[model samples]
Target: GESVGLHLPTLSVQEGDNSIINCAYSNSASDYFIWYKQESGKGPQFIIDIRSNMDKRQGQRVTVLLNKTVKHLSLQIAATQPGDSAVYFCAAEGNGGADGLTFGKGTHLIIQP
Candidate 1:
């Protein structure tokens, strides 16, 4: 079965610094990618997304980059803050629908003082 996974389980970034989170997907047919931020005891929140046709997309203070050739995805968060600490996940969908989405294990983003 196709699955998505993160290269690292945790990432620590200093306050006001930029943070980059990486993910890898096994489904080569996936056409859509999404980045989600999950706070403790809450549902994942949508951060940003990118389509297969586009190499990169930006939203607010976040950026999502997709590399189809390597089946890789990345999320960049600008200006790390205390509120930015959470578990970030990368999800992939092959059929352009949420039903077919596969989510990664998630990477814990820690904001350091």
Candidate 2:
């Protein structure tokens, strides 16, 4: 099942490692999916995005994979740095318009440097 707004965020990790987070979505009509990273006191920053028409998307050190068949998604961070520590969230564009995004409960990525 996909997540709504009632979820909390938390992350913990070591200084220089890699982390991978997961997300589950339920909307088949969603055409766009995005992954964002939010630090201690900041808003979400776009990490990567994949269109429903595509299966995967990649960014600087981030990768987003979309499995439309099972309605599942995942994000992989390579060579995670201390600064890479943050809460990660997966969002999907609603059926109607691209303006509104449905966010999932984020996973906290903690870095112990």
Candidate 3:
């Protein structure tokens, strides 16, 4: 049914390089999107977010892009670092924001030296 998923399960990036994580959602009605980062043994931490009305949003070191027509989303990280190694997930909130979010399988971001 309606679900979110990533194009890749694992992504490797060299230190100091930029990283891009992609996701796809099946729900066309989804209005809000969120990107989260989860470290080992920790819950997912909010990284960035974008609304359907907008196409892009930026945070301190991250940027989130939304493509409503294709139901695709992506997160870009600047200057990959060791501390950035984590599993990143994309979530979608639909049904007027009452039903909460549906998360993707997640992508393991590996920072390589």
Candidate 4:
């Protein structure tokens, strides 16, 4: 079973298609969530973020959806290209005034040619 704040594993998609990734957070009080994409050797780059108050957010080619009830979150990629292939993860922060954000492990996104 998926626990709150638990990380999802990986997702594989073909080039030019859409890909969806999922996440879950433990903190009901968490008001902020961020999505990151990390490449082979580089650091994780910010993709997008959403506030708990909002059910969803959209970026250039990405969209993030949040479900507070289930403590679930998801990231959607439009026209997934090879460049979008990377390890993706989600981080969450609450009103606790914590120093660092709580994050999921990561999901390896593979772009099949």
Task: Please identify which of the two predictions, 1 or 3, would achieve the higher lDDT against the true structure.
Answer: 3
lDDT of the candidates, in the order given: 0.92, 0.78, 0.94, 0.85
Q: Candidate 3's residue-wise lDDT over 1-113, tens digit each?
A: 46999999999999999999999999898989999999989999989889899999999889999988899999999999999999999999999877889999999999999
- lDDT digits (tens) for residues 11-87 of candidate 1: 99999999999999997888888999999999999999898999999888898988999999999999989999999
Q: Which ranges in model 3 have alpha carbons more than 4 Å from their true place?
A: none
Q: For candidate 1, what is the TM-score?
A: 0.95
Estimated TM-score for each candidate: 0.95, 0.84, 0.96, 0.90
**Residue runs of model 2 more than 4 Å from their true location after superposition:** 1-11
Model 3 worst lDDT window (10 residues): 93-102
Better of 1 and 2 by lDDT: 1
lDDT of 4 by residue, 27-76 (tens): 67788889999998999899999998999999999999999998899999
The residue pairs in collision within model 2 are 10-108, 11-108, 11-109, 11-110, 12-110, 13-110
What is the model-wide C-alpha lDDT for candidate 4?
A: 0.85
Ranking by TM-score: 3, 1, 4, 2
RMSD of each: 1.2, 2.8, 0.9, 2.7
